[model samples]
Target chain A: MAENKIEIRNLYKAFGKKKVLNGVDLDVKKGESLVVIGGSGTGKSVLIKCIQGLLIPDSGSIKIDGVETVETSENIHEKMGMLFQGAALFDSLSVWENVAFVPLGKGKMSKKDAKTEAIRVLRQVGLAPDVADLSPAELSGGMQKRVGLARAIITKPEIIFFDEPTTGLDPIMADVINDLIIESARGLGATTLTITHDMASARKIADRIAMLYHGKIIWIGTVKEMENSDNPYLQQFITGNAQGPIQVEV
Target chain B: MLKKTLGTFLQTLGKAPLAFIINLGYFTQFVAKSVYNCFMPPFYFRLFGMQFLNIGFYSLPVVGLTTLFAGMVIAIQTYSGISEYGAESVVASVVLISVTRELAPVLSALMVAGRIGAAMAAEIGTMRVTEQIDALITLSANPFRYLIAPRIWAAIIVMPLLVLFGDIIGIFGGYLVGVYKLDFNPANYITNTMDFMKSTDIIMGMVKAGVFGFIISVMGCYHGYRSKGGAQGVGEATTNAVVTASILILIANYLITELFFAR
Candidate 1:
């Protein structure tokens, strides 16, 4: 079995009166893809944010490369990349600049070299060289997602997170993004964690799938295993049934 | 029933001061952190330069036009009243002192509070709601260093220069009204203006300008950085930035005046 690249144990996080993550225990092996499936407001984003050190958990342990990362994640941040649900590109910079922001900001590469490198990465993501100079706003939704993917992979991080990378996209574009995610992660051999409610996306990208319900991981298994699992919540979720243990707030 | 009603009333009354204290503490911590980071290494000189141009160079016309009209009004008003007392020369001195020591600094700072402060809030607030700030963190960029510090330093450094420009323009406006409109001897008006003008007055206005600049940028950045919800949240932050900055400028103006000229 591969060694774990990321380990989360007994994670707990809550807002004022609502517990978002209740003792979530998850792990992803080195160079593996793990997708967490949950309904809206079920703390999927919060779980990833805790790992990214964007939100402080109420109690838990998150280890990356065997080092505890709850207190300080600055060093850990260098080994990780994320694609936000909104494709949160810096509007102030050009597309190439956004792609090369990390290297350019760190002064690790000259502007000319960074631009060349950014264009190369953009090409790998299926963007034309002409798209390099345009702003993030000028691109279509699909293109912005590609630019965001390019940015996440440009540094060749050890781990990458995709937060609803397929949300707000057409079915074809969503599939295209799924293919790109596979290609990029496979190319880097990076550990990947993705959170989404899209079952097709989950099945397409996940080596193992976990179901989060009411702040807990109710079930986790391989895609084939998920199909045969008898857990009622998991069964109801995967089937997209309205009659189930889970109740829609609306 | 009466006791419960009184308890609820007291609780409601107490909440305001508690919230005020909490907000003040946050604002203080934010300002202190940003100021400390402003002097740290790996400075973003490019961002600072852009902010300097935006806050300083772009603010010239509004400052110029405002002070010019204010100075003309002072000259006309002072001339009419002082002429009744057969003391027309006091109009020159009054225009010089008031424009330099009070009007230019306050009015220019207020104008900039409306323009730059609101812009800082709206821009950063939008970035916040869209999760761009979180993205920057993942990308290893500190928001304070990359965003707040440049703005704070630019507003502080550029403000006194703006006030100096305002002083010259304002005094000239008074001169225009005094000599051309009032038919006073141009040479006498110039002489009277220079004679009444003390370096202390100009120095005082510059000092006030610098303080006002700090207040404006801090309020704008603080509100924007903390803003949440979405578009409506950004809108609220913009309005709060302008209002708080304007109010603080006025308060600081009085405090600085008392500091410099208290008898």
Candidate 2:
């Protein structure tokens, strides 16, 4: 068996009376890409946040590299990078400054050298070096997403999380982002966890697919298995049907 | 129906104090964390400079104008009030003591609380809404250290300096009114002002400035950091920061005065 890079077991999270993640258990092996598909408000984002330690789970265990993360004092995110939905770039900072934020803020590199590194990563994301000095507000939506991608991979982290990476893009732009994500993650040989309702993105990037329904993982398999599976929940989701075991809650 | 209403009312009453205590505990932890981070390494000196420029230098015009008008008005009012008893000379002393001991520090702090406190809350609250703050944490940086510490330090350092400048401008305002408007001997007015001014009074004013500065920045940061939802949340945070800072400044002014001058 390959080494599991991330292991989440019996995870549960809720806000007030609303339960988001109810006993979710999953694992991502090293260098594999896992895409979680779920409807809106089905706890996809919360699950990723719980894994990133952004939200404390109400109960259960999350182990990164076999060490329990709950209440641990270690800096688990040092090896992790994420591209937030909407890009979430610092409006106050320029492109290179945003890309170099981690190293610069941590005092690990000089500004000049960090900018140089930023330009290099921007190029890898198919952006020109001249785009380095432009503030994030100056960039278009597509360009902003590219910059966010560049920042995520700037540190060449061992694990990357992409949250709704193609939600707001056009079809062509979405395809470009999906391709870039695959290339970048493959280039670093990094493990990745992506959450999106975009099936095109999932099909293009996922090595294995999981379906989350009502805060539980209803199906887990390869893309081929997902396509061939007889699971009604997965079938209802993949077909985009409203009438099924999953209620639209409209 | 009556029982249900009574139960609901009792529950709300019971929850209010608990909620207040919880929020107070959170604010105390925030302050302790920020203070501890202020002395740690990896300090962002550039951010410190930016905050100082924002909190101190930009605040000069407002602080200067407010204190100037206050001093002039105090001089004019004192002249009219004391002249009723044929004690016109007391105008110089009254204006001098009031400006140095009360007007300069308190008024300048209130002005800053309006400007800088609201600004800090809006800026940080926007960051929170946009996920930039969470981005900082995911990037392995402590938001408190990177965001809050520098502002707190800048406010504490610059507030006293701003108040000092306000004192000078305020005293000069009094001088202008005493010399030009009241037709007093400029030399004797100057002498009475100088003779009545104590170093302790100026020091106390500056000390109050420092405390008020801390309060303004802390309230701003606390509200901003805790803000949730979106634009509406940020707006609420900015308003709360200003309101709480202004009220705390007034309350603290009384407490500090009692500590310094109560007989």
Please report the candidate that would top DockQ against the real structure: 1
Error of 1 at A88 (Å): 0.6
Evaluate residue A221 in candidate 1 and report its C-alpha lDDT on the 0 to 100 scale.
94
**Each model's number of backbone clashes?**
0, 0
Report the lDDT tens digits of candidate 2 across residue range B42-129: 7888999999999999999999999999999999988877644533458877887899889999999999999999999999999998
State the TM-score for model 2: 0.97
Superposition error at B97 for model 1 (Å): 1.1
TM-score for each predicted model, relative to the true structure: 0.97, 0.97
User: Per-residue lDDT for B145-246 in model 1, tens only?
Assistant: 999999998999999999999999999999899888987778888888888889999999999999998999999999999999999999999999999999
| Model 1: per-residue Cα lDDT over A1-250, one tens digit each | 8999989999999998999999999998999999999999999999999999999999989998878897564578899999999999999999999999999999989999999999999999999999999999999999999999999999999999999999999999999999999999999999999999999999999999999999999999999999999999999999999999999889
Which ranges in model 2 have alpha carbons more than 4 Å from their true place?
B84-88
